[model samples]
Target: MGDDTLIDQVRRRYLEVNGDHPMSEADDVYVREHFVEATPEAMALMLEGRLPLPSYLLSDGTPMVPAEHGRLAEIAGGVDRLHDWFVAFWPDDPATAEEEWGHYLSGQYVCLTEVSPVRIRMKTRRVAEASVAVEILRRDPHDPIGRGMLGQAVDGVLAVPGLESFLLPMTAYDRLRFGGPTVRETWVEAPRREFLTPVAPVWPLRTERLLLRPFRPGDEPALTEAWADEDYTSLLLSGTMNPAEVAEMVRRRSEPGDGTFIGLVAEHDGEVVGDSVLILQGTGLSEGEIGWTVMPRHAGRGYATEAARAVLRLAFEHYGLRRVVANLDARNDRSAALCERLGMRREVHRRGDFWSKGTWTDSYEYALLREEWLAQQP
Candidate 1:
């Protein structure tokens, strides 16, 4: 090669040492059938690694590479620690030592899948290569185990086999349900490893006399009327909502919040009564704030109290929040009475803490611990 650069020479030598293996017909078929989805680069990587003797093989004759589940790896403190745990649990089999790969793919295949609410049927289909699809019929976010799995799935630590998928608590398995490396399948492209959007606390929460749900378009009329009755007198530079402000409020509440703030509409007898909010705060979302608003005409009926109680339960019971606080104008006796009714302990009575309506106004802060709330539960 005349006048070849040093970089070019190194590249040529590298390719010579690791011979470029052009994609063959069999390789293309294997990739298309095996991976959930693959890029051309990934296919080429698989092809290149084909020559190296794999450390092990699965029952389906698929080569076993070093692989670890994202969440498991995290729990073990690192991939190496996770591998150590695996080795301790799965010692090398003498029978597999005699095989060409010298080991076998051991352990159960565990993954996350979305539970379809519409399909109320649990079905597990096993294919020839052990490819399995489990359909979960019921969607209960309250179940502790199911909640953890859903959280992991949202965090990108757990892989969902498919949307509208099912879940069964994983335990020791006699055989792998999903296909081995030969025909592995997943909805997400493995290499990209994208994370799903974290969702707000589960909703449409109900109390004995009221329904708490997300804001929708048609709710504007009633909500606007409620805002008109709201006394912004004690609030800091805040006033009643105008038409534009009402539209903005509806639009903002309609979009999915980033797991931090949850805005809910309270309904009684098919009429919009008020709104409540749960604001997750502090590190790890360990603490939060609970807020509520009721139309002046509907205030004394205890609609705010009913909805606020449901939201408090959600904070402590569902989200596992350690503490939740509610702050309000100290002069607002209606809200102060509501806090006490909810069993919140008055934590602070800051004097003139807020500069509202061109004057300093006092504020009250009430809080409830998770244990306190749980003990109060019937």
Candidate 2:
């Protein structure tokens, strides 16, 4: 301690506080096991307190941490102190410490300027400590920025703390400037948070021969025919369809709420030819059952196949469902054929598992997973 300069003083202080905890055996093992794919931001999120990221992210379903995750007291105690220590880890200019330290340590201030040179504006929203949602818009001489000025416009997100991943939904201008054909409109990079988020929309699906949307009152005529048709309903529905019950069902699906089911009416011209339903069978929409009913009058024209494809697109693209299943009466060759056309695997052939139309009916279950769906996509 001979005539310490200010730089030496800061360096000595950081070491005195944090140097005591040289990587323990537990810390070494944790880093060895989990840091194989770890990025700077992910490491920072852990520092900020978002640990136990998603299971799928880890080599195994579980991940090891230095201590109970966010046990940063061993390193620096508080996030701000941790930032100072992180800055010391890399011998960078202390004059630019705040921004550089934030990026290096995964603090609240993340810079994405390197992500694009088109001069894009970034809008970020931290979803709890799990993920951060960002909307990017390109700014030029004439364009108006979305949030704050470029560079440090994280909206004092730096003031808050802890986030696992980020979602960047690019504006059309930004997309053309930064995105390619492979990249969707919204690019989500959550290396630590292992989950799927749909890049598409669930409503107002446009297809070659159909426009799919949530059921409407006027679509009742289409739903009524499909719901009440004995020939079609016998395989899926229980008992006879009462007009009042059918109307209630249509009314319920006409709007979006917490209900277990959402039906999309396939509108052709102004008439409803068929309707598809997605029933939430698993928590967090991990699994969904897609059922479609095209009036017999419109059958065999591939309309049902096209419409069902739209439903599957919504399930996989918009809802980020892990798996979707279509149930068909074993005897219904046409429905089975439709499921086959959509690249679904015949996973289960339940013998008389479903009781329908006063009979114990054998059911065939056709299922598709997200990976398989992606392979099938053009």
Candidate 3:
């Protein structure tokens, strides 16, 4: 039967309890409250094989099923609704449901629930007996690696039947409920850093005077020539990186790493004059660090300032970061001036706090909030 027909049948079946006097808008709300919301078990059974499984998958390959009517607003609706959703699927133990709900609410643990009879009917359909390989990772509660990664304290896979399996955070609740050696076991795992998936301003981003592109072979000679100069590298932590070292840096930055670095070389009139980067930091990738390096020959031409502005634009506008910061050696007057030109606020200065090049150097931290950056834009 069609979904509409089934919904109508279920509605009628539910409304029958009220005895047909007359149907009104109130009756629809009544059916939802009593039939759909009240008894989750019956709803689960009734909706079995009917509700479509979410085809959208998180970066980690788990299906992206937002709570309550597929809206994030519902998750923020209230704690009561979150609790109801939890008990609906995990009704066996009412004792710890409250705590489990709290964890899910706070994002301490992310619970992927199999709301209805889920069927793997996607591009790569799973066999009837097949099970998905889950990797549960544990990290500090404060450090989140963005969406699709669970922030909980255990990282491994639970072999739930079929390719579609809910990732139950292996907390005390799951250990008590699932009662498996794997569920009870916990591992202090290192942070899983995947290269960030780039979005917006697609690569080869161009401004009026500069073309920002990813590092490619043959660009290293220009980079080495620029970086090898002590005058250019002065006030820099790495000092003068050798030719081979510069090439290695180019290669590493060219490829994706740890979702932290977005490296791009700035091309001016077909010459690689500098490099620009947007470094994502903090949980949810909500903040970023922006930096640029220009060749000595390219200095005093506003290339660094132009490239830094582009990087800031990418951070605030394209990536949707909450804030962007630039940390530079205190003695780097030119860079500090560039930060001011970009409208970044000087937030911190720590004297002799940073040790670099066999000497203690002061550091400066400049920051630009999203609101501030937006205000500066035309």
Candidate 4:
């Protein structure tokens, strides 16, 4: 028979004998040379625990199967191995090597046992050989039985030299019900240093006819003018703000704290026409809300809409809010319209939710999730 026919005959015969048994050493070598290059789908099949025995015979007539093929097959069939494959290959492109490593490390399916640096060859400073040995125990990190196995694997790996550097933080595992030491204690002896220096908030979000910025001391005149306007006064908690009160508001907003309150003033041709505030909800929730009001003259120009979008962008991108919510009077159609235009959904409506204009007024709640905001981004 021809080479191709003979190879096919051998593969069929081997499968008939072994059935679904794990791959042998000769099987691995054959796969690397022939199947890996010729039949890439074999890798996926292998990962799924289906090892296709090669049909091709070795030049010396020995069967083509590697010794460790059986163990490799077992590992590949596991959930952790499947997760590692996805982490290594998926997402089309990875930004950095560390990020790629993070993809595998952060996976809920993979149970990492060890990650150690192995020096292959020692030479002069300019030339050396090195490799990383990452030994992992296959288990579902989210499952109870699997989680227990993962803990033992992690502890075993930590005892090995060079593997402790990649150990998961205790707090992280604690949250997930898996345990380990702190990253600092495991990876480094010294305390880590912060890289980015703090800075003041940048402001003055602008549009065709409006400039939105924080309320400064000198903005008292504009604040008094805008706050005293009937259209603006009716929308606010308080009707008016004196110079001292305005100054205090500005000072309090400008001061740095665990949370931030940014008071924004919308200006038209050097005069304040509207105002908005973005306050970080400091109750340990990772979110913020926007409160806004516009003068009667600027009401129909979409300035509030423009400013709110800017604030939303800032909150979603810089502040890292998973969700941002806005609470407005149910009767206030203009504010609700602006929120709707920005893709915020009305999630709640409370009857007699607030005491406004001396009587209880209904409140309409609107919110935009981070995923929604990201989808809307250019």
Candidate 5:
């Protein structure tokens, strides 16, 4: 309830650590305050109980209940599943569901389904609610039907039986959505800059538990083992290849003048645990693509993360590449999570982009710019 924004706190902390050091202000403190505020401002009203809250909060804000929600939690353990859910969406911060509960929880949050965290059975509720808030905000801002649906939603909350004061916020939001009277487009200007191109891919990268270096002919066996498993191949663009085929691939990539693709094998304790690739894209060396395959036996050990991150460092810091990207099979949650962990943002999710393994396959495209990559580094 204080006026101190997150930037103010950060600035104060910086000053404390720097012994009263002076730093030039980018803009007025008032102008910068908005940047530190919690996003989707409208949702914060209901979430914090300033406005009426609805009970039926879907995970994706679909406005319906999912039958298997509780069942999936039962299968995966409530705490662990919730933690994974949070980490998958927000990879930069290492905090889990339990740690973020106080930040998202408000007394007005209501429960409609037993499977949902709204039932107050676990630490996952606040995260689920926050996710719902975000999803709801993504709906079309000017859809006429939205007014009808949201009106129905408002009536559905009548069961909560509160004072009439909260009704005004709902009506106000409806006006904002249906076309606020003051709504109009405004033009703003920004400094123009020249287009920048990044450099070439660099070499042997190191991580905490993994040493990522160029693939050797001797790596065919380990690489084949990792790529041949059914569980692994079933999620790849080319599904279910045999060990022999994977070995041939290793040989092809191992050959000289195969500068198009560079294979980096992930070595941990002298054992091959995974393989990551950096593929130069287009005639221009400014863009690069990445791919990874980790051994089934080594799953969940963070080997994929270490390998991907090291290669990313090479692509950005050493190679001066402007952009690095990964294309992942949509069903491969682990790979998608690894991309997120590498600070890559999901830019595309193409539906059924290809047919593979006896079914249509979708793909997720994640990317990071050189500037973004640099910001992540120490």
Candidate 6:
């Protein structure tokens, strides 16, 4: 038989052991008609047991080769030798893993050493010991199952010595293909200098009729009353707060950081009548949301609208925000109208966005672009 015929026979026998029938002459003709040449190195690697046959044979989802089960029978040494081979082949320095050889192994591109009797399985371990659950979970942060698995994996790696001091958390790619996690370093770039600057809270923002400033200790009485209002509590502040709790809220607002907290106190006659805030969302975005509440007695007087507009101006003008958005209940026409008056356009109407009063309610999103605000500025 020619080299091509020999390889086809080997491939057919290999598949037959896994319960696939051998291909006939007609099948061989079809395969040859469409066969693409494998690189010399790839073919050599396959012959030397450093790589498995082409993945097309195993496309059916069943294990074409019993990788784990045949380990002992195929190799006299067992998993320790396999482990040693990986450790030897794995770069001692994590930086080297980024090179072509490293990339091949890291990416699982080179399927070296098929375990005869058992199909050889491969896995990449996370090189760093740090828990990256927060980073991964941030995008889908609320997924309890994903969080749990990530936590378990990190803790498992940390339990082993030498793996605990990594700067970033490592990910296990192709867990099913590989019996264990393959270790690879997670690469993270340093933040730019601008990201490290301290961000200031919005203060003394002025609308046509009101000045919105940071919260003060003296505004507790007004805040307590505002919190007690049924409409304010139901629509905005759903949680019950006592004097001390409200004081804590004020304290957090006054705390400084690039992520500054902003609390607004609407003053008409040297007395606090309304409260609003423009807090930076913790995700490092330049945009923020406006949250506010007005005393029931002052509701019709447009205190909330004035306070919100002041906060919006502070966000766009002073904070250099690209955009600012507000999420409010779709049914709250009063608040919705206030958003429109401030030149914020409705961007989205989320269906079943929130659960309240035992049922899901839609949410309305209002956003104002910096360009729009600048154009409107007189």
**What lDDT does the true structure give each of the candidates?**
0.53, 0.53, 0.56, 0.51, 0.51, 0.52
Candidate 5 C-alpha lDDT tens digits along 1-378: 333353244333323322332212322231122122222332333333332222222222211112332243354465345435533444554564444433222212222222233333221322233234323424632222332232222222234311111221212222232343211110000000011123324545678888887777777777666565677777786766577777777777666553657777888999999888888653224568999988889888888888888888777656546688888789889889888888899999999986777788888899998789889889
Model 3: colliding residue pairs: 134-157, 136-155, 136-156, 137-155
Instruction: Output the lDDT of residue 276, model 5.
Output: 86
Residue 107's lDDT within candidate 5 is 17
List runs of model 6 lying over 4 Å from the truth. 1-193, 196-198, 257-260, 282-284
Mind sharing the TM-score for model 6? Answer: 0.50
lDDT of 3 by residue, 1-378 (tens): 564455455444333322233324443333233222312322232344222222222222222222442233244364335446544544675755555443333222223333321211210122211111122112222222322232111221233232224333333322323344321122112222321233435678888899998787778889888777888777878788899998898888777665468888999989888888888865335678888888888889999888888888888777767789889999989999999999999999989998888889999999998889989889
Q: State every prediction's TM-score relative to the real structure.
A: 0.49, 0.47, 0.53, 0.46, 0.46, 0.50
lDDT tens readout by residue for model 2, 243-352: 77888877877766654476787878867888788885542235789988788888888888999998888777666566899888898888899999999999999998
How does model 4 score by TM-score?
A: 0.46
Q: Evaluated with TM-score, which candidate comes out highest?
A: 3
Per-prediction backbone clash count: 1, 0, 4, 11, 3, 17
- Residues 307-343, candidate 4, lDDT per residue (tens digit)? 7887787777766555788998888888888889999
lDDT of 1 by residue, 50-77 (tens): 2112222222323322232133445657
Which segments of candidate 1 are over 4 A away from where they belong? 1-198, 230-237
Q: What is the lDDT of residue 230 in candidate 4?
A: 62
- In model 6, what is the error at residue 319, expressed in angstroms? 1.5
Q: Please write out the lDDT profile of model 6 over residues 1-378, one tens digit for every residue.
A: 366654565455335423443344553343334333343444344445444443323232211221332234235464335433443343564443334233232223323232221111112332221235435444653333333334333333234322223322212222233444433232211111223123564356666777777776666777776665566666552666777887777776665544555666888767677888776542223567887777777778988877877777777766656678888888888888888988999999999977876668998999987789889889
Q: What are the clashing pairs of model 5?
A: 198-320, 199-320, 200-319
